[model samples]
Target: MDLFSLKGKRALVTGGTHGLGMAMAEGLAVAGAELIITGTTPTKMDDALSYYKRKGFKAYGYLFDVTNEKVAKENISKITKEIGEIHILVNNAGIIKRELAITMPVEDFRRVIEVDLVGPFIMSQLVAKQMIDRKEGKIINICSMMSELGRNSVSAYAAAKGGLKMLTQNLATEWAKYNIQVNGIGPGYFATSQTEPIRVDGHPFNEFIINRTPAARWGNPEDLAGAAVFLASKASDFVNGQVIYVDGGILATIGKPSNED
Candidate 1:
């Protein structure tokens, strides 16, 4: 049997217009899943759709904010009606606010939580309802290194992701009876367009990441494809409530001394 095949599966990936989300969505598509990507703007959605079409892959794009519960529900319902039941759901929509806790405004913290934590909850609940009825589904939450570790100036992001880790477990426990699997992917620093400036040679942050990570390099967006495909496919039928850290073993070891051999 082709355990990793996603043929006939329909996957809904939120915030899939670009970056890591797009990479994971492409992985599923290559594995034979029908792709439905979501963005918050029509132009972004159209552009993503066009890109996929140009690649000879048929994809659907929707403009919906996952944090808006009403809009999420409405759009999800519309998607189901227009396309079909979503067999896989990737909660990839999130935001980060890089402000120290000491001076960070209360509103910024709330906004980060709303987008990173609350948004996935809303999306999961709505999609899980359909999957529950069908007796099977897969939900992949886009968690982060912050989900387990803390860094400076990202208090809000860390808190939200930490919460999301537990949420993933809780959903898995509650939905396991219905044959649904809920998991998370904690990605490390990747060499993406968004991090282009910081990834240049001699950049402090870039040097720090290289030294801190056991792999001594930044991750590529495509590096996450295998994990995404495994968690989204039947190969993970028994794996639930797990957070796969695709962080180049950063979470596995402490760190080498700067002067160590």
Candidate 2:
């Protein structure tokens, strides 16, 4: 058997219109799974679907707000019916507010929590029901370095991700008996279009990230593909409740002083 192959599987990736989510979805597709991605806007959905189609990959897109439980449930049912049984789910939909805790509005904080943490809870629960009935599934939650370490101006995001880590664990514990594996992927800084300005050769944050990470560079979105595929495929059947940090060994050491070398 090709243990890593995802043939005959159908995957649902939330917030996969672009960036890291789209990268992971592409990985699953390359591994032979049919892809269904969710986005909040029809334009983004259509564009993403077209992008995949142009690349000769079979992909579908749906417009839905993952944070709305009713919408999530309804859409998930529609997907299962119209597409196929979703054997893999990637809860990549999330939001982050880069406001200082003391100055951040309560509503903004709540909104981040709702989208980042609560949304995943609802999505997982709805998808797990079908998996439970089938007695097999894989769930990958897109966590972050915030899940373990905290940074300035992102308190709400940190709290939500920290909660998501535990949520991944709890779901794994509860669903393992039914052959469901719940895991998280904690990505570090990646060099995406959104980070292009900061990724300049001598930018302060760029310097910090290069020095901080043992790999000495920002991660490419494609860097996450293997991890995503592993967690989404039968290759990870025995793994459960783990958060694989794809941070280029940043979490492994504090850092070398600038003067040390």
Candidate 3:
């Protein structure tokens, strides 16, 4: 349990104002990490800060576009000056455009790539420089099932995530010697507000997810907390460049036939 403690550690989570990012950030806070959350929305940031404070966690918020390397660099510097040096970085900021590859605009595809893949790259580079100097750090990229399998209407997303998986491994290999661990968390279908509509009874997509997952249910946002904590703490010091899938066994097997038990 001591190995899992993150006391006195500063964790910077990009896009952490809501959804799964918030869930993971909360997990880190519960394990004693000081939170430095980043997001693009002011209202969301305020709400998240209030929530964290209400829960008695030390938290700070910064707003910025992570994909813009220049702005991100400035903000990272500002954060270090005002808050503290970052010991853990969760590259969870990303975007997806649900359009068919055939019909998707090149700009939209590029935008998705910029945010989902390049944003992590930018954030990691800036943060890892500090970690390299200190000789220790943790980096967790939020990946997805698309990182492994192809899905309809998500061509750009799959491409970016697949690239991210490789990037995780590559970064881990390079930084392992410096005692910096780079890992990824690939989530499965989850019961988020974004998915609430499709998660209701008898919805085709909801039923599909329920039947598809070996665990027989969609993942709860909280289901991600433990993995996030592990990857950010001393518990995973030796774990590097790996993507831990939290998709309820969705990737462990081919989907069962709709008629099969």
Candidate 4:
């Protein structure tokens, strides 16, 4: 009877093969939602599907590149045909490429935008239409620290994430009348496949991160899952167009690092 429980709901997560995507899917599955995950790699998809299957969770995988509108529409249609209406959508699929803006190729920037920004827009539009017919839905966009603050290099990623923030609000403002709650979760530095290089390098970046973050550590994937579930459940029915920061207080601090007194 908990408001946060996802029992009897169906969720479709884009980019659910690995990293944060898989973590979110698993979180929803554990919350008792039937999960459908999409990704580009069949091998990874099969792996995730089998892993969840072994866990006795109802999970399925669809192969499609979300950046491609045609492919996205096609896969969505196919999924709708196979499964009934998807009540929850977790737009967790994204890509990050670090490069200096001046030196970065425009093609790389466009590609990142295609996947991180436009892809989410397409999926949200497609799914929101279906939710409109049902008069209810939940949309959780996976944003980033870069959505509000920027760092050295990675201009395209910053732009894409920032745009995603606004897109989330736009969707919520327009869709709230239909009983849909659209919101976002902006994660700070998290240890995942995306950050393995930084972790493996044992660079000062990690130290800087710990010192900068009030929590003094990077977040794990599970940290964001609870927020996703909350946003997707009845607990957050009134929450709309808001971006929750699960950054361990990274966004709260400014100035140089300080050691304990």
TM-score result, candidate 3: 0.99
Worst 10 residues of 4 by lDDT: 252-261
For candidate 1, write residues 49-76 as lDDT tens digits.
Answer: 8887887776998898899999999999
Q: 5-51, model 3: which lDDT tens digit per residue?
A: 99999999999999999999999999999999999999999999999
Best candidate, TM-score: 3
* Model 2: per-residue Cα lDDT over 1-261, one tens digit each: 488899899999999999999999999899998999998988888889999898888898889899988888899899988887889999999988899888999999999999999999999999999999999999999999999999999999999999999999999999999999999999999988789999988789998999899898899999999999999887899999999999999999999986564
Worst lDDT 10-window in candidate 3: 191-200
Cα shift from native, residue 232, model 3 (Å): 0.5
Enumerate residue pairs that collide in model 3: none
Report lDDT (Cα) of residue 142, candidate 3. 94
Off by over 4 Å in 4: 200-202, 255-261
Q: After superposition, how far is residue 160 of candidate 4 from its true place, in Å?
A: 0.3
lDDT by residue (1-261, candidate 4, tens digit) is: 579889889999998889888888888888889999998989999999999899899998899888888889988899999987889999988988889998999999999999999999999999999999999999999898899988899899999999999999999999999999999999988899767777654587877777788887889998878988899899999999999999999788783535652
Q: Per the 3 Å backbone cut-off, how many clashing residue pairs does candidate 1 have?
A: 0
**Candidate 1 segments exceeding 4 Å error:** none
Candidate 1 vs candidate 4: the lDDT winner is: 1
Preferred candidate (lDDT higher): 2 or 3? 3
